[model samples]
Every structure is written in structure tokens, then in C-alpha cells.
Target: MAKPKAKLETLQDKEILTSELAAIVGKTPQWIRQLTRDKVLNQVSRGKYNLGEAVQAYCEHVSGGKEEEQKPRLIDFKTRYEKTKAEKAELELERIKGNLHAAADVEWLLSDMILTIKTRLLGVPSRVSTECENESADVVESVVRREIETALSAMAKYTPDQIGGDVSHGGPEDS
Candidate 1:
């Protein structure tokens, strides 16, 4: 006479230790414990798991089962936030180094420069009119040329120290 073996029932009928489950899942026992703590895996008893349920839960977790964020995802979010913060700090440093200027300051400077040029040019006709009137054609031409040259000379020189700008901060480059 031979002894008969009892047939296994459901997959949950088999229970395994954490270390054994960790080996089957190809992860460290510590990582298995972490998954247990996160409710991604269940325990059949202390240090043990139902094989079938553990496998099913692990599959759903890996498949991104619409659960809350995991540790890895939280790490990724932190990395992106730090990267953005660092970029903003770099921009602020560049601005402090005077490598950048505000739009309002630039606009005001341009308007002032244009007004100065306009004033100098408009004054030329008035200043030279009397001298030009009583002179010969060549004399009148030279007087007008000298007045225009004076205005152009002023236009060629620019310094940030004038009015609202600070020389130490430097000025905007030519557009």
C-alpha cells in the first residue's frame, strides 16, 4: 500500500516567508518590507505572505495601479523642484552682476538719449541762422556744417552716469 498526498487548494493556500518572497520577486528583503509598509503587499502572518495575493498586488503596483505616489516618484518630484530653484538662483546672480537690466530702465534711457539728440539738433538751426544770413554761399555752408558737426559730436558720446543711470552698473549695449 502507498501513502496518498493531499491536493493543494487555492494559490493562497501557500504561504511564504518575507525572505523567500523577496527572492522570488528579485528584490531585497528590506524593499519587500517597505512595500509591505506601503500596503502594496500583504502579510499572511508576521514575516510571511500569501504567495498568490503578494504576486497580484506586486503586479498591480508595478503597473501603476492609480495608487498614491511611491518613494521613487517623490524623489523625482524633489529633484525637479531643486533644479528649478537652482536655475532661478543663477538668474538672480547674473542680474546682481549687472549682466542684465530691467525693461523700464532701458526704455527710460532710450527716451532720454533721443530727447537730448533732438534738442541739440533743433538748436543748431537757431544758433547758426544769423551767421549764415550775411555770408557768401561757401561761408554759409561752412557755418551750417560746423553747427551740424557739433550736434553729431555730442551724439557720438554716451555715459550711464547721466541722470537716472549708475556708472558702476554699466549700461545697456547698443541695439
Candidate 2:
């Protein structure tokens, strides 16, 4: 398939195709289209442009005469960069101050506590089965509850000391 070319309205007209303009301007056709979109270049038709006017516009665009419009964009970029840098620094300081713990450390702490409680609960039946067999129902129940309470009490005495430098990624240290 072939596309129809735009007809020149008059022999005196000075229009050029996108590719011709790009070649003369030392840029890609896409670059020409972008400049046109940015209002730095003008098109005489959908894919044709006035060669002299397009070149003049491109020269003006590259001459820094458009600095006023670009300064806000530059300032905005620098502002965002500084803000992000400050945020990262603040987070780092907070982490070093022991105000935050790594996810891995928290995960380890919970897993350790759960395993301890599970072990304690699993041992209860074996340790109290014979004693419970001879005791009253109330006594048996009290024994089981006491064992569970002891296991739970271990969690109440929570301490981060155990999450020491032993972790693969060094734990937060106290100064």
C-alpha cells in the first residue's frame, strides 16, 4: 500500500516534507515533530512544513531565548531532588536512632516467640497426662491453664536484645 502525497498549491510555495526538514536541521523526524508539538516549529500541512520558517523557529528554540519558559521546569526538578534527599536523610537518621526496626528483625522476633509457645504447649500433654489422670477435672484444667499462662508471660517480657548482630543484615545497634 502507498500513501498519497500532499499536492503543492503553487510552484512559488516553499514547503518541505518532515524527513527533508529533519535532514537539513540535523535531527530525527520525531525530533522535528516534537519541536512542532512544542510550538518551536510550524507545519504547513500534516507532514509538510515551510522550510525557512521551520529552520528559523528551530534556531530560536536552541538560542536560549526560551529560557523563561524552561526555568520553572528546571527549578521544579531541583526542588524535588532536594526534597527527596532530605526525606531519605531523615529516614536514615530515624533508623539509626532505634526508632525503627527492619522487617526481617520483626519477623524473626514473632517467629521465635511463636515457636517457643508452640513447644511449651506441645510438651504440656506429655508432662501432665499422668498427673491429670489422677487429679480432679478442676485441677487438670488449672494445670493446663498455668502452663499456657507461663508461655504467654514470656511474650509480655519482650526484649529486642536477642535480635543482635547475629542477623544476616546487621540489626540496629544502640549507641
On TM-score, the leading prediction is 2
Q: Worst 10-residue stretch by lDDT in candidate 2?
A: 166-175
Which residue pairs clash within candidate 1?
none
Q: Give the per-residue lDDT of model 1 (tens digit) for 1-175.
A: 9889888678666899999989998999999999999998989789999998898888777765544644345445667899999999998897677766567666767776677788988898888887688779898788878887887777667654332355543334432
Global lDDT of each candidate: 0.77, 0.77
Residue-wise C-alpha lDDT for candidate 2, range 14-85, written one tens digit per residue: 899999989998999999999889887878889999877777777767664345753644446677899999
Provide TM-scores for the models.
0.47, 0.51
| Each prediction's number of clashing residue pairs | 0, 0
- For residue 97, give model 1's deviation from the true position in Å: 2.4
- TM-score, predicted candidate 1 vs. hidden true structure: 0.47
